[model samples]
Target: MMRIRHDQRSNEIPTPAVSFQPESVQMAVMKEKLTDQEAVVAIGQQDVRVRFVDGVPSDRSFMVRLVKQEGGTWVAQAVPLSSIGRFVPASLDDGIDLWLSARGIRLTEKEKEAVRRFWETEGGSIKQKQETVAALTAKQLEVTETHLRLAHEALHGPPLGDLLAPLLTKTEEPEETDEAKGVPVREQTERWEGSRAYAAASELVLPPAETRTFVMTAVTEKMRQLVHDFRVWQRDMARQLEQFSHAVAQQATERATPLVESLIHSLDRMLLNGDWLLFTDMKTETKLLEAGAKLAEAKRGLAEGKMDEAAKTVREVKALLESLRFQPSEQKVMRFFLESDERQGMKPHEQLSRILKQASQAARDNALSARGVVESLRRLGFFHEQEAARALLSGERLPPAENVKAMLLSWVEEGTAPAQAERVLMNLTGQQLLNKFTADSHTQTMLYQWPLSLHGEMATVHVHVNARSGNGQLDWQNCRLYFLLDTNQGKVGISLQAIERQLSVTVETESEKLAAVLQSYASTVKDHLEQIGYRVQRLVFQPMDTEDEERAATDRIKTENETSQWEWTI
Candidate 1:
């Protein structure tokens, strides 16, 4: 519908014959070192459907002339839109010259006058517009140029057109002449009826009514039946094409459904068996779970004949899978984590789950009172501290220690955990961790603090419990753990704080050596915690500010040992 005219003749006048070789002009330019003022005109002229306002499509032709500026970058200005129709559309090289000369672009007086004479000879008006009719801004021109380049690339190859020249050249169809229209049936019949042989045959023919009745009842009915059959066949083919389009749209989902289902089932099994934390904050697992849910939605949409929705959902799933941050080595580790049975007996949360169940029942005997519930939360809090420290000591494989360590440290420092695990598994720390942290009553608060040891390292855990509510169910609202780890070089101050029920870790020490050790081992600790369903925040390392470093270390260790008491104080 958007037509580009070569001349200002409206639709009535026939176009003039004009030709320009773009290749010839380009070759000539390549042979010479062109000056800045003597610009080789590059035109991005086209009639396109552009959205000018409110995303409404408008048909407009643009003639942009790009000139090389001081630094070799091209800057463009819009030529009068009417200039596009002044020259032949296929004559791109001539059109560029015409546009430049019309605007008096970088031309000598003699050259400009010669171009003006040629324009006049071609019936072009010398009365140019004071300004470009619909000029685009520089940014808009850049976008237009990019679109033009892409369009050129799509239409023509990067090669010198030699490879596709035959295809590119216009192959004009044969024009239908009036003689080729063929003789009409009425004319042919009239000639036959006027012939002497036709007159002799007419004399032996039946009356007009009898002849008409025979043809209508027999030949005409037969022809009508054939036409109806052909129409039915055409309708059947159209229905098949519609069905085919739906099939194509749904094909990807159909192919991926089995694989996706298998992976989901595998993940479910892994979580159920307590293979909890492969990495701190099972984000990869969570994404896969979400993808599975979306895949289900897509299936439903497809089954209900919502092809567009199904296609869109499938694309989203593809993108998510592609965007997974796993490296090749990490991918292998993930596969091992999913498929290997190495952690069968070492289910990360097995011990924690058993201990919580016992604590829960013991607390329930007292009608789920705040004191009893706080005790359970206290035990759970201390467990994570011990586990994190233990993992640090073991130097466990965490999907690349530094990244995981960094993630955990950020979580710790920012106190921001990723999206909460949906339906935190009741069997593991899910129900226990979320349920046990709360406020002790409205006014009077209940707090639980305890110390834990990991291979001679000392740590303290603090749990703030909410008292019995009107429903009689108690919850722990906040918890924190402070711990220290001794490395070969010095002492590292490691603290894990779980505020608002989210766990985070921090490290502090006077010695840079000890900080490095903690920094290296932090990811291992995070990995272990994550495996155990502990979403740990990032790590924070701060230097001990004391002047007497040895004394400071002694004081820190003594303070931790002094506070290593299993006491429940209100």
Candidate 2:
């Protein structure tokens, strides 16, 4: 293998100065963070040019200008010889081979043998250890950056000055109360539900499914804390603004005024979304709107330096925020559950079936038994264990199933729950909820017999549908169909007596050729049927025919021969 060597450096490759310049200097400055014309020129100049000899570079060179490190050290990066202009390869493949050989990546015969042995022994563990090291390095870098940012903040002050400037400039104008900033409420809810559903259907279904509930509960509590914290913080800010210097007071006022207005504005927007209305009543929404108007008035007063009026308005806003509560909507939650992309082009029944299948697989993966499944549903407050069991056995809907689904979706939005209705659903297996709540259930087997005309002959095909195992392990052998050839293909005597004799006894044949023909036919038929959902379960072949009389005589002769042989030997 050929190796590239630079005379100025040790065994380690020197670090190269990295710069991005996709096009002209002006374009680079605008898009690639090239600060000035000098920077662009520095990056574009090919100060170091490399030439390849045999398979390796004779001298370490680059297409761009190389910037040296503090001690006049430079970084080296592998560049394709094709881009260097001086080195031309025979062909693309030859160039690739040369590149690999130059990098010592292409092994020698002895090295290849050694590698093969290593792979046969410890390749997997070595590869795994390398990945672990890489992951740790990346994590370390991330933590280091976070610590650096924190240190910078502690040394200086918070970066609030930059963030508050734009808002503070518009302090004179009344802030716009209600406009959608992020995703639409409906879309956000859909995305949240879709993510939850996707997680439940993934390889680790039970954990994600259970985790969704836990996360939602945590979010609700967190949001509650946020609202409380913000209100208290605003109250303190309002009090300080009246007593502090104008600069400090002005900044505090700017921050507090917008925060209150934003809180009220977001509340109004959420109320506008019908999903939010499921948890909040019309009376509550109307009250919230009134609070928002008061908050706006307070903001105006604060801006105008009317401290008393602003204080009075802040108190009103705080009271309204306290009065506001969240509750989950049943219909909206159900809709979220039912939502799916039409591009999959599945029927409603099919989609429901798929969801149930995923749930069952999730349960099995989580090591949940039938009784455990029932208990999970009861724990989720979907229904009592007895009720869930009965509902599953009878394929009936549980009474509290809607509420259970609604509670499951409480995490979709902060204000999507009623305190009483949104209870923590612990250890609720997704499969159990699907099995206990849904009316349609998974069937173990389905047999369908149909007559088909094949090769100018009529035959009956029996299709057996074997439901997959709870964990989604498909027993392909058990899920098949059997084709029974009609006995009327070859004609017997046309007389009534002959026909009666033919029909009286079962026709059995000892033919290897027939079995081969039937096997081919079964495969062809199975493939075609499966395209339209009728999958073959198993093929049951008939027993081979034999001559019992001949076999019995042969057995007696063999026994006599064996006895004579034994006597002679003795």
Candidate 3:
């Protein structure tokens, strides 16, 4: 519970009057004051004047409770710093007990412990903590009430109403009418007919044989359209150059014409040779876009009669295009996807390692965000389409689906580029395929996979949960959770199994050096799990042998019944 104080003796303090606005808590920084009792404080983005009911704190900052008054004024009450530490309990279980007890609901010791352990191993964050707490509290209340009722019945026997009920005259059963019986039969027939019609309709809609082939063909067509747009833009630029002075036109042509021609030639060769995948690197796409923007700037300068500016802009454009002449290779594209940007001040391995650690914690703490990622990709695709449409309407050409698709694939695979509609659609289709395969397997395993972008690099995380199900409800108490992380530093896997509130964890990696690094943090991980209230039965860091990689891959595909032991190996 929270306490608020109102001091009538302090005239400087605003009276605590009720307002329509809800109460809120915020942190505030105390500033130097005009008087002993009056001082200014920074609360969020606003500077507020507050009068202390008690003496003002000597400390620089503290948490404050703010309440709105009827006159639209805010009254601030400083929370004692000492009391703030008590907000989070020393143990998660203790916290759960306290909350339940506060609600006038009491549970047996075993029941209380069970509730506490559920909170520890559950997959949720602070954002959903209260909801989980409320649900658990309600469950305990129901269980306790049931026990009490059972005890009452055992001691007192059946109720007086139950004894009197049997003494009353029996009521005659009513026979079902023909219409009632026919109604159900008719409904059953209609349902069967409707389902049959739906099945027929579904069979008529033939899906693509190979989604990859469909995607490749669509991308190739988009690339061709982009090339056509580029040619039109080139002709428009040539025409615009004529508007400039003769000297400026000659200088611009000398600088820009060769570079533009070279770029178009490269694109033409790639499109004709069916080697667009070689050009999927986001850096190359960005350079190409930058070159276009410079050309547009040059055109604007020429139109404004700034011949010197236009010539300089053309020179910049020439330099940018010259940088794009490097030979594209599979290795180079993979490197582009894996490498972190130098400007971000972190190596690829370091950035990925950090992301992996955060991901491990998030796997236990947060709800899976795979669906959110798909939604984001959809939104981004729509945005890119709108941008392209606007550009077309304005007679300014934006690069076509080739560049957009390249960017989107880069984003999906490496989390480096923007999302495009084609890639989003392709991913959505892939998701459907994944669902089909998973359903066909008839397994009680839940899987979620998503890409995480950090410090200009991307890491993919895959989570698998195996649990028991009865009465169509999953039993999380006896469940196994596996997290697989793929990053520049290599793959790291974590496996957690919880049974009756006891948790065992195994962390595995292929590289011995990486395993050694994670070894130092093993205890920290265990402590964190324990802090959440579950007993840490075992925590192990086992590095896999390089030679065993093939064997490990074979073991992973074994059916649940065939695989006697679950191993977390990367």
How badly does each model clash, as a count of residue pairs?
26, 17, 0
Residue-level error in angstroms, candidate 3, position 251: 15
Question: Candidate 3 local accuracy as lDDT?
Answer: 0.45
TM-score of each: 0.19, 0.18, 0.26
Off by over 4 Å in 3: 1-55, 58-123, 127-227, 241-310, 315-570
Q: What is the C-alpha local distance difference test score of each model? A: 0.36, 0.34, 0.45
- Give the root-mean-square deviation of each candidate in angstroms: 40.2, 32.9, 26.3
Better of 1 and 3 by TM-score: 3
Model 3 residue 105 distance off true place after TM-score fit, in angstroms: 34
Displacement of residue 544 (Cα, Å) in model 3 is 22
| Top candidate (lDDT) | 3
Candidate 2 achieves a global lDDT of 0.34
Count of backbone collisions in candidate 1:
26
Ranking of models by TM-score: 3, 1, 2
